[model samples]
Target: MKLPEINTATPYAGLSPDLVLDAVSHCGLWPDGRLLALNSYENRVWQVGLEETAPVIAKFYRPGRWSDAAIEEEHAFALELAAAELPVVAPLVFDGQTLRQHEGFRYALTPRRGGRAPSLESTTQLEWLGRLIARIHSVGSRQPFVHRGRVDRATLMQAPMQAVLASTLLPASLQANYRSAAQRLDDAVAMRLEAIGPVRQLRLHGDCHPGNVLWTDEGPHFVDLDDARMGPAVQDLWMLAGDERALNALLDGYTQMREFDDTERALIPALRAMRQMHYAGWIAARWHDPAFPAAFPFAAESRWWEQHIADLHELADGL
Candidate 1:
């Protein structure tokens, strides 16, 4: 039987077990054939066991998503953080090269670091996380990315809104309403950002949610700098805190390590608004990919779109 051509857009479509093992072996490692897929939607990652050795992780980059320069910048940043004794899991340098190509897939290998989600309920944990993030930001401020992108309204809000509008997922009935709400919300977010004035932009772990952080007896270790980009320091700090008290605890720890710009606090609402629209747009853009629908079944439902529109309107009002 003949199979379909998955191509670049569907990079993981042809990633069979045999191909995965081959990719690992091509890296000069002996694969024991025990493979476990990790939780990652943007890229394909696996834990490959070795013969009489500790298992290592293999991450296959999504084709056409990032240029070689951008990916190299990310690798360099990870190595910088690691050199400072930070807990970031840097890619393994085999034959003096971290990035490698095998079977037409670009990939990197790393030692498998283990830990569970950090307990955000504890003040101590939150503070510790804050200090680590501040350290990260300090290093991030020392340099800038030439080939990498930046986190801004254009990529996070305007572009995403345009993509979602172009997608067929939005019901015709709610399409007009969504357009109006999204536009209004975009305007509101713009005004809010303007009020915050000129904030400093530093390289950040753009998607610094709880899932990217792992906790162990030692402390927190950040993983998946895949979304790393130039952005405000607050962008890394906001997602980890739920309330003012939590924010205070985090800032307290952060300030101890580095100066925290209090003015950046005002941009949180605007950032939140962008996140909502960006998420919807991300789902819409990737709807053609099989993983998206299974993960976001609600995107197909009209009711969900209605709620999303309503939520956008409410967020706009608050902003």
Candidate 2:
């Protein structure tokens, strides 16, 4: 399927320091004149200091990425998870509204929660996270997201493949290799998914990588539902599992709350491949965004594309 061309124009060019401060002020919060930019490339996230209280995190959505309804679905999911006593950082409802707009930029505020990355090496931590995720799935299974996306070939694999092909960064010489590798990976993914038939799909903490998980003395708390969508339960688990031991540990905790379909294990390899394709495509699609080029300078190098193509082939073979 032909996808829309990536927007090459700089979308955040007009998001000045004054505009950020003014946006916060418009939300009825007095800024203390201290704004620390968070490590986010997809959206503009800032730790905004307040006059008397702890700083709050203000996130400005990327232009044209998600519709208002889709974003609201994300916010609603976070709020639902928080209300269930889960440690999800939900957007604050100001004037009975979680989604707000200022000067054409949509944004939201959430109270800042600080913590370091979770120790994935520790079995205890993985099991703990497993239980938390199972509980999240329990709530998520109650209903479906009306506006969010699904984890599938078209979105994760095909769309990304198109993005990479469309980008000028992929050297003309390497284009054929990249295309062949991507196609093989896509076919392999489709075959694997087809063999699995159908499985349960539910709301998920779509981007459940360690970076999105913060750990304190208490336990793990999930943040950044920006990629939250509908998918198999394993979509939330595979990224956190590094090896057989970690996967077992997570499942041990997970089974305590929800009965996982053992068949979902087969989807992991395919999902991993899809994620790889998606990452390259994401960088390509967002290359026009100034931060992407600066953060992923390697993507501009021909050598990087060569390695990526080789990796795609390897992944396809593994599948």
lDDT string for model 1 (166-258, tens) is 988998888789989999999999888887789898889888999999998988899999999998999998899988888898998999999
Looking at model 2, how many pairs of residues clash?
0
Q: What does candidate 1 score on TM?
A: 0.96
List residue ranges in candidate 1 displaced over 4 A.
1-6
TM-score of each: 0.96, 0.97
User: How many collisions between residues are there in candidate 1?
Assistant: 0
List candidate 2 segments past 4 Å from native: 1-8
Task: Specify the highest-lDDT model's number.
Answer: 2
Q: Which lDDT values do the candidates have, in the order given?
A: 0.89, 0.92
Go through the candidates in order and give the clash count of each: 0, 0
